[model samples]
Target: MPKVLNITAARSRLTSLVQEAFLEQKRTLIGKHGVPMAALLPIREYEELLQDLEDLGDMLQAEQEYRRTGGKDFEDVVKKPKGRR
Candidate 1:
């Protein structure tokens, strides 16, 4: 489960919070006025999340393009040889 920290508590323990986020791979949700506001996470974890999103986007785009192009198989589009070309 993720750790929840209020704004004032997060500010007061910024260093320790950062350490926990990095060394322990812990996620933190910062809240303000009793409402969730932001999160603090490790840079590596953020990078991995971005990479996963980009990969998913690429896959979806490829699928869309394939569907738009009549969805033909590769063998159906290959040119046939006529009497040894």
Candidate 2:
């Protein structure tokens, strides 16, 4: 689990927390009034997460397109040369 810090405490140790995230790949959670609100993680992880979300979106779009097109198999749409079985 990540270390949780309230807004006041996070202000004082922001530098150290950032260092931990960058150097050690540690995560930190920040909260206000005891309700968790934000997090700090390495930039690489954040970028990968964004990429994963984009890939998922692309998959969803492809699925919708397939359904709209009556879900024909790729091989069925491509023509084969005669005697090239």
Task: Say which candidate scores most in TM-score.
Answer: 2
For every candidate, C-alpha RMSD to the true structure in Å: 4.2, 2.6
Relative to the unseen true structure, what is the C-alpha lDDT of residue 60 in candidate 1, on a scale of 0 to 100? 100
**lDDT (C-alpha, whole model) for all candidates:** 0.87, 0.91
Which lDDT tens digits does candidate 1 get at residues 46-84?
999999999999999988999998687778678677775
TM-score of 1: 0.75
What is the alpha-carbon lDDT for the whole of candidate 2? 0.91
Per-residue lDDT over 1-85 for candidate 2, one digit per residue giving the tens place of the 0 to 100 score: 7656899999999999999889999888999887779999998999999999999999999999999988878798797878998
Rate residue 37 of model 2 by lDDT.
94
Model 1 gets an lDDT of 0.87
Residue 14 displacement in candidate 1 (angstroms): 1.0
lDDT for position 40 in model 2: 91
